[model samples]
Target: MGRVTTEPSAYHRRMAEQKRSAIIDAATGLFLDSGYDGTSLARIAEAAGVSRATLFKQFPTKAALFDAIVTEYWKVEGEGGLDLRPGDLRAGLTAVGRRYVALLTRPRMVALFRIVIAEAPRFPELGQTQFKRGKMPYFTSVRRYLEAEHEAGTVRLDDPELATTQFLGMIADYVFWPRMLLVDWSPDEASMARAVDEAVLTIEARYATSSARPA
Candidate 1:
């Protein structure tokens, strides 16, 4: 093979990414410190050390900036795709489930959820966009994992979407609404483990074939 060379465009792309990340970091800090209504575009631009025009160019509207922040919150679990291999479907799913709970149960993400829910009535599109981009993808991935496990004779599932929903519900029942929205509770490791274990057992019980059932 001939000698490889990096393109000049790559340097510009890296600089652009760094600038965008700085803007996002500034916006997130401002949003968290001051409620959405209190934060202004000029304040964000000042915090980012960029001009208003540059900030506007990167994020045309306040809603767009908020949407980007919300998207990042949803991805706090990192990008490890769920693996449903031949061995133990329930165990594999539990590993993913624990990680998912870890994301939802984080205090920062909890605050982010509260912010989204609080502003949702004024910015309905933001809520809808987040649901489409975040929740739907997560639900679909989990459902597909269950479906594949069913096909591989590792587990059994009737209506994989419903099964996935039920599994998530088991975990979210305690963590999502009550702790994040209604109450002022902070989640700990032991509590998170208990929740994930119960969720795993519930999902496995619903999907395990007769032969695959635990004793």
Candidate 2:
């Protein structure tokens, strides 16, 4: 049998993806350990086992790499895996709340927020980019869900967008802020469950239509 030859283009593409993933993995760890300003491209290149030229070829700037990290971590499904049970508003909200909490309280996410806040003053665009790309999509998804529930008469909200923001704020207040600010703060499963339960209750009390209530 004749020897088979691999296509040069295919091999290069596969190698490129591997190198990109390695850089992202290394950068994520270093960025979390050392804040944005503290970490450098050279350090990331070393950690990723690639040369400086390779790192720059993949990500031309630090901001580009940081944005990539945010996109990777913050990209969640539009519905956030909410189960839209027709009359079970509480259950749906609880599911969404739990997922939201998981996303917000992840260690890498918390670290990224800290980095953005710390470096935003110097690079204002970073904050804007994070808000537009990382945060807005989740907000929009929640708003769309609330709007759908409102149209279905399952919830009664004058402004679905505002209600969505408030619901997210409630969850963030209980889960995200503490984790972000306190170096050693870690909530047990029971505490997290309680928080999500409380959040769901709060949202339902505020917005659920009388008809949506379980008989």
Best by lDDT: 2
lDDT of 2 by residue, 1-215 (tens): 99787766887989988998899889888876786778999999999999999999879898899888887777665553443544567777887787788788765788778778877998887798789888887788677778878888899889888788888888788778887768777788788878888877888888888888767
Candidate 2: worst-modelled 10 consecutive residues by lDDT: 77-86
Model 2 quality (TM-score): 0.83
Best by TM-score: 2
Name the regions of candidate 2 deviating beyond 4 angstroms.
1-18, 32-38, 77-87
Question: Clashes in model 2: which pairs?
Answer: none
lDDT of 1 by residue, 178-213 (tens): 775456566677887898898888777777876666
TM-score of each: 0.80, 0.83
lDDT measured at residue 104 in model 2 versus the true structure, 0 to 100: 84
